[model samples]
Target: MSVFVTVLSLSSLATILAALVSLADYHLNDYGVCTININGGTRTVDVNGGSSILSSLAKHKIFIPSACGGKATCGLCKVTMVDTISPVLPTEEPYLTAKEIEGGVRLACQVKVKRDLEILIPGEFLTVSQYQAKVEKITKLTYDIKKFRLRLLDPAQMEFKAGQYVQVDSKLYGAVREEVSRAYSISSAPSDRKAIELVVRLVPGGICTTFLHEHVKVGDKLTLAGPFGEFYLREGADHLIFIAGGSGLAPIRPMILDILKRKLDKKMTFFFGAVSRKDLFYVDYFRDLEARYPNFTYIPALSGAKPEDEWDGEEGLITEVVARNISDPEGKQAYLCGSPGMIDAALGTLREIGIGAEHIYYDKF
Candidate 1:
């Protein structure tokens, strides 16, 4: 019995020692230098080898749009190796389309910079910059939506289009304590240079939304790393129709303000939808804007209004109201922002109203 106890203790100590050694090696091992050629070698980044290419490029301020935070799930961190390439990994196969495979596209978050490599990035990446910022204000926009304003600290400023969105860095909660990022659109006009604002609706279990709603207070430092998406105005568009719901109004507000600031003389009609009066917000803001822009009209549609609530406005689904009102969309362009369902319904209505598919634009929240 004594001999057996001694053997068991020895085994346990050995296992613990092995774990410690393994961890030490992972942390202490030397990763030689690697070079990444960017934009056909128009730019290059020298970074430590053996880390994922996404992390390497991000360190140098080149951001690849990733939806799953830097994890491999979202399959958005796409890259085309411009140097010699390796065979695709099993983890990346499902995400790559056959065309992407033929074109040498691989997941940037998964590929390590094992050797000198060249990569091709979309043109938009050159314009996106990461920001270190301080929270300037956090105001209640509605009962459930709060507005956060971030005054950038480093690079100190940015130039983004009216409808573009940025990903806000988030601290983890529940079982996740690591820092991560989530995307939200800029609500303030681009003319507001010093600070940018975001309207965030509380998602019950959302990592970033929950942090902003519960833990984040008035003054906190943060890092945000994006100016992503291709949803914005199309100048020379014949006429403009805008649709939005809930916090989707964030992106649309900038679009409206952009139009106003630019003195766009185009015909514009804006529709805001809500489940009930409680869900409705920013009606007064829109009303004031409509008064300023004679060609612009603001319509508020309520899908679940109560008669006893003494409401007087267009009622029913936004799409239904749109179908009833707009009879001609032959030369019109539609911009939509809302929940996925509302945008989908609005798209169908545009189709039914004889609008060309090419004339519709949307950014669904």
Candidate 2:
């Protein structure tokens, strides 16, 4: 019995020592540097092993556009890996295609840098730069939506297509102890160089939105990286149809303003949808703009209007209202922004009305 006890103690000590060694290797012991050969040797970054590929590249100022800040939710930081790190993770399964998986495409956020690696990234992303910004003001647009005015402290001027978006970083706050980033469309017109605006609706249980609504202050400084996404007006599109729900108007607002700012002869019709009158915002602004621009039309729709609201505008689902008003959508370009369901319904309606799938652009969150 004494011999058996001594052997058990030895085994337990060996297990503990093994665990300590692994912990040291993972977090304490410094692994030597490794090189990341990017885009077929267009650039190379030497970073220490044991960090995520996304973060390692960022240390070298190579900003890969990630809306979820390496959390694997946005799936924007995908890259074709020419070298092996590990198999595709379950967190990345939903974002990758079968071909992408077979072709060695991996989520940069999920892959750890343990050795040298080769990755392929879009050449255009090399142009993305990080910016420092300050929250100049916050305007409550409705019960749930608020407009944030961010003044660019660095890179004082940003040249982005009106409908593009930027990933805003939320620093540590209540319930969220670590920093995170989420993309928000630019609501401010491109002509406004020094400052940009974002219209955000309170997303229940959303980390970034919670930080913006609860923790962020007017004078708080934040980091933003972007001008990403490709939901912009097609050049020389003569007729445009804009449909937005909730805070989806963030991107559409700037596109409309872009047209008016250029004094372009493009015909514009904007449809804004909400549940009730109280859920609506920016009605006066769009109405005022419509009054000024002869070629622009503003249509606000309420899907669930209260009797006390005395709603006189279009009622019922926005898809139905759109089908009724727009007779021929064949040659028109449609820009949609909303929840996935809203965008899907609008797409089907537009397609039925002869709008080609390619002509309909959307930003789905």
Candidate 3:
């Protein structure tokens, strides 16, 4: 036989073997199935034993709070390992403390379900379920921010705390092939259980925000889950201070409104910060509330105002304004929502004004 023919035959055989190997790996290398014993076997889920625990649980409609969408960057999907605990991974170290690691806590997004596992999550999470919602209205709040009112289609109504958040799941679009979920604080009063509102600011190059702004329509149906986060107002404080900037106003609005609607005896002062006149929004609504409710006060601040903007309110950074107006924060509870920088600055300012760290609650964007 000729050398060229022999070489050709060998090359063809090699390609065939490679194809057969791939086929076998796809069909025969299955991880089988494993059972997840949850909350002391109060609930058990049998699932394929290869994917991350986050994805596995999600498949069973068991949604864990994940701000970064299972990337393990947010570290919000932590679950206690009841049966067996894996060693702490480096990706999880930044969010976990030594004490947490010692307690067998792990980020569910980072843990692989290779075998039968036992885990523990909060009872509240077990109650959380996915909802079908239709966008009832889309109102522009500011140049970059928009308010979305979603009416619940399934289960008819939702029962979320005023300051809790929901994860909106966006359908695949453009380069995105799989659905994506992003957490946004609910801006509607809890009493309005049939519909929930969210104020979203457009983020440059953000997948979900881009989809929301450009593609979603007023009547579009969307999937969302939750009532997540621990940023709700606690009872018993005599005075309440709400400070927010940009879309951070979401949670604060519902909280303040709930207080006003219930005619709570507690006094509330809301400090809204903006870079200029155009950056501010919801001025009329809050102003109206303030006028009608004697215990409610609305203060809008502009840090950098143009002459044509005709702004007259607190000036300088929001933290500075908060510190200047509020003197004794001894018995006051503060709810702050803003960027990380603003949140940190506000925390420091609150600390300086005799406010205990325990009383200063915040949600950082």
Go through the candidates in order and give each one's C-alpha lDDT.
0.85, 0.89, 0.89
Clashing pairs in 3: none
Best by TM-score: 3
Clash counts per candidate, in order, are: 0, 0, 0
TM-scores for the candidates: 0.84, 0.89, 0.91
lDDT tens digits by residue: candidate 2, 1-365: 99999999999999999999989887776668999999999999899998899999888878787878898988888889996668899999999999999989998899988888999998866777788999999999998899999999898878898998998988887657888878999999999978999999898998899889878889999898878888888974688999999999999999999989898889999988899999899999899998988999999999999999899999989999999999886559999999889999999999889988888898765
Model 3 root-mean-square deviation:
6.7
CA lDDT, candidate 2, residue 279: 89
Which candidate would rank higher by TM-score, 1 or 2?
2
Worst 10 residues of 2 by lDDT: 172-181
Give the alpha carbon lDDT tens digit for every residue of 4-102 in model 3: 999999999999999999788667767689899999988999999778899999999999998778877678998999765568899999888998888
* Runs in model 3 lying further than 4 Å from the true structure: 1-30
Looking at model 1, the pairs that clash are none
Residue 108 of model 1, lDDT score: 94
- In angstroms, the error of model 1 at 365 is 6.5
lDDT of 1 at 87: 86
